[model samples]
Target chain A: SQTIHQWPATLVQPVGSPLSLECTVEGTSNPNLYWYRQAAGRGLQLLFYSVGIGQISSEVPQNLSASRPQDRQFILSSKKLLLSDSGFYLCAWTRQGGDGYTFGSGTRLTVV
Target chain B: QQQVKQSPQSLIVQKGGISIINCAYENTAFDYFPWYQQFPGKGPALLIAIRPDVSEKKEGRFTISFNKSAKQFSLHIMDSQPGDSATYFCAASPPNNNDMRFGAGTRLTVKP
Candidate 1:
């Protein structure tokens, strides 16, 4: 079975600090990866998605960026975080032409 | 343009009742419809999905009803329980699309 891992499970960052969240999927190759953020009591907002290594599409332009370093490794980063950046970030993967997606545990970011 | 539109931003139901969430899509090319469930501080998980070829699909207490001609779909949760209190999202995607568009989401609270 495939498993997705994301870390750190929870994060507290100061305003203007750098941010890095990593996601890795085991037992799958060349999977579509996505980054999403959910505000408190709100639905998910798609940030970015990648089809292959070094290929990323931004759904919404913001301070955050995503990268696919390897076939199974994806990273979300920001040079300087903003208060608005605080939310629950999720990383998900799906096989090409697959029915549904598998999501990681998620990273709760609190920017103070 | 936002391809998917969901209704009833929030809903409250009594235990053992039924919970229904509706969604409509503008894109006729969308051939896949999926419903995702998310708990507080957690990532969304795939609950159920349906292809345009099917009118309805059921899994345990969850069901997905798709209307291909109307470009609409809905999720029905039977015998609602407090454990089912969470946010539910509706999503649509074409067969060849790499990205899936998600609905605004509906927060469902089943009170015991």
Candidate 2:
């Protein structure tokens, strides 16, 4: 079975602080990874996606970036956090040519 | 612009009733439509999916109705239960497209 892990479950950080959220998948290799952000009571916004190691595609221009350091390890980072950057961050993966994605538990980030 | 649009941002349903959520897309190239369910503080999970080739697909209590000519699809939950209360999202994607476009979510509350 394939599973995704994301941490920390919740985060509270001050404005302008650096941020790092990590996600990893087990039981699969060369799967496509994606990052999505959902504001409270709002729609999900695509952040980034990677097809392979060292390859990332950003969907929107924002104060964040994503990296695929290893085949199953993805990281979301920001040099400086803003109040608007707080949201629920999710990591998902899909097999090549698969029908749907499997998502992680998600991280609730609060930029205070 | 959002590629997929979903309606009824919030819904209240009585247990044993039916819950319906609709979604529309403008992209004619989209070949896949999927619905996701998310509990509070958790990431979304793939609940059901339908391909453009099918008009309706049912899995247990869940059903997806796709109207290819109308460019719309809907999810129906029969005998809605309290455990089914959660947020639902609709998404669409074209063939070979690595990115999936999600609609604004609908929050469903089934009162027992």
Candidate 3:
């Protein structure tokens, strides 16, 4: 069975501070990984997705970026945090040409 | 058309009742429909899914009804319980595409 791990279940960051959230999947190789952000009223929105190492696609341009350093490791980072950047961040993985996705526990970041 | 429209931003239901959420899409290329459930401060998980080849698919108390011609699909939760109270999202994906489009999400509350 595959499992995903996300660090810092909850985070509080000052505006203009740097942000880094890491997610890694176990038991899968070269899986399709995605980063999503869920707002209070808005549903989950795709922020970024990576098909392979060094390949990332941004669904919506904002103060965020994603990188797949290793086949199973994905990281979401921001040069500086913004008040609007606060939300529930999630990491998900699915097999290529697969049916469903498996998501991590998620991290709740609050920008104060 | 890459958008998915969902209805009933929020719902309130009594325990033991049935809960239904609907979604529609304009992309005929989307053949895979999935539903996800998310609890407060948690990541969304796949609840149920179906393909256009089938009109309906059920897993335990959850069911997904897909209307291929209408380009619509819905999620049904039978015997709703307080534990089932969460936000539900409908998503559609094209077989050849790597990205999936998610609905706005419906917040369901089951009063116990």
Candidate 4:
């Protein structure tokens, strides 16, 4: 079975600070990875997706960026965080030609 | 532009009742329609999915109805339980498209 692990499960960052969230999938190789953010009471916004190592696609321009450093490892980072950056961040992975995605537990980021 | 649209931003249903959520898409090329369920602080999980070639697909208590001509789809939950309370999102993707577009989520509360 495939499993995705994301951490820290919860984060509290001060405004203007840097941010880093990591997600790694086990039991799958060459899976497509995605990063999504959900604001309170709002729909999810796609931030980035990676098809392969060193290949990242940006969906919406914002303060965040994503990277696929390894085949199974994906990282979401920001040089400086903003108050608006606070939200529930999710990591998802899907096999090539798969019907749907399998998601991680998620990271609750609170930028104060 | 938003390709997918979901209705009923919030829904409250009594236990043993039926809960229905609707979603419409503008893209005719979308061949896959999926519904995801998310809890308060967790990533959205794949609930049920239907392909355009099929009119309806059922899994346990959940069902997805797809309309190819209208480019619309819906999720229905039978005998709703409190555990079914969560946010639900509708998503669509073309056969060759790697990215899936998700609709604004609907928060469903099944009260026991």
Candidate 5:
């Protein structure tokens, strides 16, 4: 069974602080990883996706960046957070020919 | 061309009734359509999915109806329960495309 792990279930940080959210998958290799942000009462916005290590594609221009250093390890980071950067961050993974994605528990980030 | 639009930002239904959510996309390249369910503090989970080749697919109490000509798809939950109250998102995956487009989402509340 494949499982995804995301850390810091809830986070509260002051504005301008650095941010780091990590996600990793077990029981799968070379899986495509994705990062998405969802505001309260809104749909999800794709932020970044990676097909392989050191290969990340950003969907929107924003204050966030994603990295895939290891095969199953993905990280979302920001040099400085803004009040608008607060939302629910989710990590998902799918194989090349997979039909759907498996998502992590998610990180609720509050930029205070 | 990559956006998936959903309808009825929020909905309220009685238990044992039916819950339906619709989604539309303009991209014909999208071959996979999936619906995800998310609770208050949890990440979205894949509820059901249907490919363009199939007009409809059902699993348990969840069913996906895909209309290829209309480029629209819908999810139907029968005998809805209070525990089924959650936010639902529709997403599309284009063939050979690394990213998936997600709809705005619909919040469904089933009152017992």
Candidate 6:
């Protein structure tokens, strides 16, 4: 059974503060990983995706960046956060050539 | 521009009634269509999926109907319940493409 973990469950950061959100998967290796952001009462927006370690693709250019430090560890970071950067951040993984996606619990960040 | 389009931005249905959400895509290369269910402050979960090769696929109370000719797909929930009240997202992906495009999402409220 594959599972994804993301933390912290909720975050409150001041504007211009640095931010880091981590996600990890167990029971799978070399899986496709993705980062998404969802505005309140809105839809999911693709932020970044990685096919392998050190390979990250940005769907929308923003203040956020993603990195794959290990085979199953992914990190989302920002040097300076803005008020608009507050949203629910999600991490998801799927096997290569797979049908379904498994998503993490998500991180709700509120930029103050 | 959003690659996938979904309708009925929000829905309200009574329990035991049917809940239907529709999605359409313009990309002919998209062969896989999937639906996701999301609860407040949580990540979305894969609800059901269907391939263009099959017009309809059913699992439990969830059903996905794909119309290849119309470039449309829909999710139907029979005997809707309050527990089924959540936001639903529709997504489409081309073969070998790990980046799946998601719809704007529909908020379904199944009243008890």
Clashes of each: 0, 0, 0, 0, 0, 0
Off by over 4 Å in 5: none
lDDT of 3 by residue, B1-112 (tens): 3399998899999999999999999888888889999888888889888989999999999999888888888999999999999999999889954778899999999999
Model 1: per-residue Cα lDDT at residue A43: 71
Residue-level error in angstroms, candidate 6, position A90 = 0.2
Per-model TM values vs. the true structure: 0.97, 0.98, 0.96, 0.97, 0.97, 0.98
Q: Select the stronger candidate by DockQ from 2 and 6.
A: 6
DockQ for every model comes to 0.75, 0.82, 0.77, 0.76, 0.78, 0.83
Candidate 6: TM-score? 0.98
Residue lDDT tens for model 6, A38-83: 9999998999999999999999999999999999999999999999
How many angstroms is residue B76 displaced in model 3 relative to the true structure, after the best TM-score fit? Answer: 1.4
Give per-residue lDDT, candidate 5, residue A111: 98
- Against the reference, the lDDT scores of all candidates come to 0.92, 0.95, 0.90, 0.92, 0.92, 0.94
lDDT of 2 by residue, A9-53 (tens): 999999999999999999999999999999999988999999999
Chain A TM-score per model, please list them. 0.98, 0.99, 0.97, 0.98, 0.98, 0.99
The candidate that achieves the highest DockQ relative to the unseen native structure: 6
Least accurate stretch of 10 residues (summed lDDT) in model 1 chain B? B93-102
Docking class of 5: medium
Better of 2 and 5 by DockQ: 2
Point out where model 4 deviates above 4 Å. none
Misplaced by over 4 Å in model 3 are none
